[model samples]
Target: MEGLKECVANLVVYLHPSKAKCPNEAILTELSSMLFTYNETFEGVVLAYDPGNCSNLAKILPGIHPYFGVKLTARILLFNPKPDMLLEGEVVKITPHSIHAVVLGFSAAVIADEDIRGEFKYKSKHGKEVYVSKSHKKHKIKVGTILRFVVKSFDEEILHLSGSLLADHSGCARWLDKNSDKWSQADRF
Candidate 1:
């Protein structure tokens, strides 16, 4: 969530001669192909796009194929997580050695045992696995729980993230929000 942002870009979408009848649709289709993939130019993964101010007249190149370029201003939503940034995700799987979560319902994140702080201990309850905080019994992480953690590294190729739970400010997001005042007061000492 921390890395999500919107940016405006001036783009030229090339269209084949056959698609000249509906240039708008052809442009949309070309931009849609960029969704959910990492682009080095944008330096992030594109989540969504909106094309605006399209030119009715396109420039037809002199090539034999006669491809035309449609110019437009586009708004793009991108996700580009960086090291030490705090991020939230849903716990999809849990084990003694590692915790697996999905960030933004797309990126996969993993927090290994070493990355998890010593304040929490892994345990089983009702045949369910969880990581429980030793200091705060109400604060725990289990499957489906929304967790906040620090980003250690990210693999842009596969949209995979390496996360850590070593900060006092990181844990169950709901619990942290609900008990913000109390947590802050306790953290002072």
Candidate 2:
């Protein structure tokens, strides 16, 4: 794994609890606006071992104090409305050096007024052809079918994820509350 020499370190520095510098109100306002529109609530933050930084530690540990080699932590947020509807045990296979993954056993429901149409699509790799319903009868998928998927990579230029999806889902709510402790109740602006 490529060690996160600067990126992880920078994230740790930015999320440090003792740090006084934080995102400005304007940025927070924008985030709140986006969250509200999406019908999702901001969750707390979670600290986890950064895989990238762990590589760097291996090379530097001999010269530095052994105690300094502990895994570095990265912060992530959790969202109420999952970025996508994913079922447990869904196989998520990530392509190395790419920001996309293949998800298996997934189905989506398209609800139209007075009628519900269930559409199924499966894509196993990025840039690959997606298999969709050619006939209505072909769309019948079991509840736990392993459907192929190509999810946007977290490290994509636009997504720029700080950590893994699981990490974000675990920590986002807590981080929001803890970081907002200094704000007054009326600071929702």
Candidate 3:
């Protein structure tokens, strides 16, 4: 019964069905618009939304009929990551030859030195040279500094990021709030 309730919580009602029709074309268009939004936004994923009670439906149509219940249907979207994909992440850690970053809720990334424009190399300690980027020297990635990288290889959920193409600051962009438009608020949080 608990599982059943969980499943019901995720359900959405599809407004339109095949062979369904309404007298008003305008109302039909609105329904179609809602349906199309669900289809495209989720890439065919099933979800739920609470549109206010259909009191308007009673007004538009000349009937005492009222919608007692609503049911929606949608398909699930699949996960698909592509090569050479550009993404922004945070500087989680820095190593001698590589930088580790976390992107899209996962980790184990190795950023190529050439791709990181913000990183500055410097030596530290008792003649034992230690290389650290600008952020690494501070021991923390500064807020608003969005690290950008290209997907060199993704295998078994591990991504190899390259900074080679980003060497000239040509690839890396500034703060995401002002510089980027690709990642939406929903995608970020």
Judged by lDDT, which candidate is best?
Answer: 1
- For candidate 2, give the lDDT of residue 71: 35
**Considering every candidate listed, which one attains the maximal TM-score?**
1
Worst lDDT window (10 residues) for model 3? 1-10
Candidate 1 ranges beyond 4 A from true positions:
185-189
- Model 2: weakest 10-residue lDDT segment is 107-116
Per-residue alpha-carbon lDDT of candidate 1 for residues 58-149, written as tens digits (9 for 90 to 100)? 99988889999989999999999999999999999999999999999999999999999998999998989999999899999999999999
> Clashes in model 3: which pairs?
12-72, 13-71, 13-72, 14-72, 14-73, 44-75, 114-163, 115-163, 115-164
lDDT of 3 by residue, 1-189 (tens): 000011112332323333135423433344445431223334321223333323223222233543222333323332223446565666565544566665544434566655554445635456443333453243222323346656665443223334333322222345333434433432466
Count of clashes, each model: 0, 18, 9
Q: Lowest summed-lDDT stretch of 10 residues in model 1?
A: 178-187
Residue 20 of model 2 has an lDDT of 20
Q: Residue-wise lDDT of candidate 2 within 134-170, one digit each (tens)?
A: 2332332222333222122233222222222221121
In model 2, which regions exceed 4 Å deviation? 1-73, 77-135, 147-189
TM-score-based ranking: 1, 3, 2
Give lDDT per model, in order. Answer: 0.93, 0.26, 0.40
TM-score of 2: 0.19
